[model samples]
Target chain A: NAGVTQTPKFRILKIGQSMTLQCAQDMNHNYMYWYRQDPGMGLKLIYYSVGAGITDKGEVPNGYNVSRSTTEDFPLRLELAAPSQTSVYFCASSYSGARGSSGNTIYFGEGSWLTVV
Target chain B: AQRVTQPEKLLSVFKGAPVELKCNYSYSGSPELFWYVQYSRQRLQLLLRHISRESIKGFTADLNKGETSFHLKKPFAQEEDSAMYYCALSGRGGDDKIIFGKGTRLHILP
Candidate 1:
């Protein structure tokens, strides 16, 4: 079902440039999230949405923005790329919150490696 | 002010030996705990959650509210178990925000 898909598996952006990381899930999930993975810092939540047309900031959301126009898509936008943003980004989704047993488990994308030079 | 800590960055265990990956969390209220594993060049996936109280791939973790720990353990380690393991936590109820630990790379040596 392509669980979760991310575009541009790898990308390099010039300093001060802007780019968007596209993420889509075919499982019809209601909750979607964007996370950045560094070498020693596990995964920091950038932004997340509970449903379509609803978005909220996460742990590390200062340099990024997000929009969830639909239930299947949650795109992360980097307005001004910086060298500090150079890391692996992952998109994930879950059917709901921590209510159920199995359905709430999150599914992740293959991850996009971004290098800001 | 919620945080998940995985004290070890890397752990090596001989084949058929017992294995344990320590995890401790800090949260004021009840929290949901999870263990995620990422294989080489693969997406991160859920290995187990504390709510389910079930074991997956021979791995089990018991939530200790008193100690605020949810450590993953396996009776016998296998080479196939080599992967990066992350401990995660989330607030109770509708809060889907899950924070993850730095992760521990488990190396099963033969």
Candidate 2:
């Protein structure tokens, strides 16, 4: 299985430009999340969805948007990109039906590198 | 508010030496803790979680609720043990949103 897959592993955009980071998972996980990792800082949640058709803002969701159109796909949208938005983006998913009971490990995708100039 | 902290930004140790990656968290209620590791040029993966109470890749982490810490430790550090490690925390029964620490980069010398 492909597990978690992300597209356009590397991208560069001008300031104020917009783009979408596509993510898909075959594990059929109910919880999906988008996170950004800076140089020294760890992953910061941008947005998340429990399942298809439901989404919520995360700790650092100011400049991004997300949609859970299907159980396998959850894409992140960057509007008016800024230098501050340049970072490695990771998409993750997990089966949460048995949360706090089982391993419930979160599987992450091979991150996408985004640079804003 | 829930927060995770890894005080060290970088740590270097020689091969066959003991290794410890410090991690601490703050949460009022019982929170699920996890250790995620990212090797050079590789995607991040789960090393272990407190609930599972299992050791992975010769690494083990124990949750100390009294100190709010879940430090990762290994007896004999190996060259392959070098990587970036992150400590994460999640609430008990919500959407399972996790908060990650700043992460520690462990480098093993030959």
Among these predicted structures, which one has the highest TM-score?
Answer: 2
Cα lDDT for residue B95, candidate 1: 67
List model 2 lDDT by residue over B1-110, tens digit each: 89999999999999999999999999989988999999987899888999888889999999999999999999999999989999988776764667788889999999
Local error of candidate 2 at A28, Å? 2.0
- If you assessed candidate 1 against the hidden native complex, which CAPRI class would it receive? medium
DockQ of each: 0.62, 0.59
Segments of candidate 2 deviating more than 4 angstroms:
A99-102
lDDT of 2 at A74: 97
lDDT of 1 by residue, A58-98 (tens): 88999999998889999999989999999999999887654
Indicate the docking level reached by candidate 2.
medium
What is the Å distance of residue B32 in model 2 from its true position? 2.2
- How high is the lDDT of residue A36 in model 1? 93
Q: Rate the local accuracy (lDDT) of all candidates.
A: 0.90, 0.90
